[model samples]
Target: MKFSAVLALSAAVMASAKSVRNHYPVRRESHKKGASSELQSQLPAGMAGFGVSNTQVTEVIIIWTNPGAGAPTININPPAGGAQPPAAAPPPAAPAAPAAPPAAPPAAGPQTHHVTVGGPSGLVFVPDQIKANVGDMVVFTFMSQNHTATQSAFATPCDPLPGGMNSGFMANPNNSVTPPPQVAMQVMVSDPLWFYCAQANHCGKGMTFSINPTAAKTQAMFQSMAIQQKGKGAQSPITGGAPPAANPATPAAPSSPPAAAPPAEAPPAANPAAPAAPPAAGGGVQTGTGQINGNGACVCAVTCTAGSFPAAVQGVGSFGGMAGSLPMNMMEA
Candidate 1:
């Protein structure tokens, strides 16, 4: 009886221990052989536990503690017999912003040279010849009647050179209330330049100017030369700067002398040797041809009386004195 009681007690203790193991499984680090080391490496650091899974016969819920955050759960429900793939790394960070643009250049100073055109004067360019540098600008302000700053060759005083600059005629003839117009010519080249007014007889009247002239060929010399030559106005064929004058007078027709009236026909002369001399100083008559009477009859050679010959034969006349015969007086008839 004592041996049997001891055996029964040993069996009861074994049953209780097996029941406790099945009811509450103990947590343990995985140490099973043939377990995927690659799958273990894919797991995030600080993984705490896993969850139940229907598929993969091994569903796993990752409980990991993120940096500076609470522990979060990541449930991985891969297909049966398959491992869950690891999450992809984040994209590379964006580049920094670009640098600023460069600064602009400084502004230039004001223009120094200037020329006045027709100021107070009826037709003139004041201070016409001005010495200027290559970069200087010359302002031309018209202050009075018509004028132009037309570039010309010094040798050909009033004429404009090909490709030379020209400020077209600015005309304010009556000196109205409006301010005079202005045009500016820049000094691009260092050589001397000649200019003239191209309005009407302004150029002819020696309305000219020059710049940078040599000592030998100064403004005085150019003016003297221009004075001798006729002024080629703006409307000239070469420069063609100005328009034609308005309301130009029409030329009158020439008068013609009046024609003389026909002389009164005289009665046939009694002597046929010499026909009645043609009435003196009236309409001219052919000397060799007989005079025709008012009745359309021709007197031929002083022999045939008036109306004796047909009108068609009237042209035929006496050969005598025919060499000096005058033309028939058609104008008088």
Candidate 2:
């Protein structure tokens, strides 16, 4: 019941109040789709100890309309009064936003585009990563370079390329390598973008970077990489590919065992008969014609014969006081 009464009173209070208006400059044409808001205030009626009492305001709102290419048209209003409005109704409860710390002024009057950088590996330069703003119409030069200063837009399935929702404009610089009349694109503060050095593997070399993005997240990513490097590794979180096998042995061929014993001398005999070495099978003499008076020795008289079993030795074969017709160690004569 009380809530209903308060609502009625709030409406009545707003109906009786007066309003004032004035011009508030629009941010810029680039901020066409952008929006800005502010808060205003009204003080209590009197000075301290004299007649000051904090009163509640009824309500406050910003009414915006378009202003053409010429001087901007604006109106700042203050709510009217009847039975002192509640404190909640005037300007906003929140204070006016502090003016943005002024951006560094553009280089003295369009200085020559002395600052020149390359597109990494034929890749288009990523926008926000380049650290430029809407008014910064930068010229990026390429050489058979496939680089583009593309926008990082806020579209569903978020993409950073030719098509994007919150995209900043892009431009290509003209150089001897590129065609004449260098190109450029002025960027806006509202977008984030990324790019690569397209000549395969260039980005992996750290040829890629970004600008004026949500600074902290990138800082953490890079910082972590650095901290890890202090230990080991230069890039992402993954660690780099194991140690070898133990020693192995080979076998040798089997060898023959040494001989058992040295040879011995033949035993000497007492009456060793002259070895009748049966006439050397391949070289011997027949004795059919000779009379074997005694078998002591044999001699070669007329029938000259060679002897065997003794090299360079002469022998005599005789019996019964006659020279036996026999040869010593004979051969077929």
Candidate 3:
């Protein structure tokens, strides 16, 4: 009897379970259909038929007006052509810095030119004339004894030109002092300038130099004028910007003894036609190894007031070393 009671209870439990199972499926289907209908009603007429497929879920974008204040009403769809809006134009690039004109190459530095104040042949300045610009420096190396690099005017070669520069006397005869002495001066002007040895009569003997002379104002003309002036160089400081003076007088040629001729028109007499006196033999002559009056060696001879020395000297003879100073013998005579 107990076994039969147990069997009846089991049957009752089974039937109740079956009824709950059947109702669960029906509720699930109804809930799903309600959700689908609500979604379709909210969609626009154009998107009404666009529903999620059984295999895949549809994507929808909802746009709301005045965010946080209004509900979403429009659904944004991706463009059909798949084209994207161009990104905002990059902020106008800062105007390209005007291409720096290739920086002008720095102006060339002032040039330094070297000139021998007196070469081996002491009577004359080596490369006596030169062309120099305003910024250039001309170094005059006084390599010999008893000489001065003095500034003078083209019009007055031996005499100082106003506003000119002068290098004081540098007497290095026999390389007597150590370190081989020299004097230097910068070319401060572009116009023609003249220089000479101011030691006594050096200027008269053709110890002169020039810079940037014009066609009309030439080096030869200046030397000729200096020989005529026959003046000593006055003390001058280094300076520039002096107005040029009138052209100097041409130098008179040394008069030679008249050739034996018929006494018809005699040549005009030269007032100071004395023969060039030769410098003393030893030590008095600075540059070359010859007598000034020897073989027409010296043309323009002048007296030296600065010590017992040759007042002037010149490189006139054929010998490369043939320079002549005021001959002591000539001075004695």
Candidate 4:
């Protein structure tokens, strides 16, 4: 009965040990025959029964089963002490800072600048120089006299630049009360700009202006150069119109004078004539004084009886009376 009771207790303890080994890791150790005997002696007395010898009872065999192929671990029992302090809680997270507002944009609108041109102060741009950015405007108002705001180059301060801006002649006559004429130009770049008055001799008198001038190229220097150039740089602004006509050709002179004409010829001469006859005695007659007949012959006056005069005497004269007688018969009173 004692052996049976011991056997039953051993079975129970073995079952309890198996339960602990299955739940946690364990290590196996072999004991010597002496140690087995010592364990048997520690058991309850009178275990040698039911045909079991004491030596056989002292012989012990232990079987250990391990399901995993892992290294053995050693567990150290905690020292007698109070429980471990709770893990310190992590510091509370700092509150996030408030977000900043977005920044504002810069100004981007265009601006305008006013310039007085040719005022009573003389030929000049009231503010001869200025600084301007792109998209800015420059308006020129003519205050006195005729003038023009014409773009030019630094090299030739008075001459107009090709394809450059030009305000046509704005005439602001003296003592005029009306508003002066205005011309405007928009800045397209930030580069330096040169300008001049295109009026006669105005540029020569140093009427010049500039925009965004550098130290090396200043408005005063440009005006000085313009003055030195005098009217040489002055030019007419192109206002579309007909071109000037070309000059006519000159006439050539004659090489020499012309030739003169010849003189006329004379006529032929006529035959000579004879002398005349004398008058009869006691006859009242006139000689050498005669009249021309229808036949173009001359006849003389004489006194003679109708039948007494000879027929020869009547027809004796050819052009006039005979040598000493009347050529025609005459009667007494």
Which is the leading candidate under lDDT?
4
Measured with C-alpha atoms, the lDDT of residue 84 in candidate 3 is 32
lDDT of 3 by residue, 8-46 (tens): 999999999999998876664678899978865654322
> Candidate 4: which stretches are off by over 4 Å?
1-108, 175-177, 231-333
Show the colliding residue pairs in model 3: 145-173, 146-171, 201-311, 278-327, 279-326, 279-327, 279-328, 280-327, 280-328
Clashes of each: 2, 38, 9, 11
- TM-score list, all predictions: 0.36, 0.25, 0.36, 0.37
lDDT tens digits by residue: candidate 2, 1-333: 699999999987776662221223433554433433122111111111111112321111112111112223232222122111112111113247668866767554221121123433333232324445433433433333333222222221112333321112212333233231122323334344333333334334333334445654452343233324332335443322112344676666677898878778677667867877655443343454433677655443332243333333332553344333334334444
Report the lDDT tens digits of candidate 4 across residue range 241-321: 235666886778866766655555455455455445544555454545555656665655545523344545545655653
C-alpha lDDT of residue 218 in model 2? 58
Predictions in order: lDDT: 0.53, 0.32, 0.55, 0.59
Model with the higher TM-score, candidate 1 or 2: 1
Which lDDT tens digits does candidate 1 get at residues 68-132?
Answer: 11223233233222323222121123347459645745535323345666756645666758776
Q: lDDT rank, highest first?
A: 4, 3, 1, 2
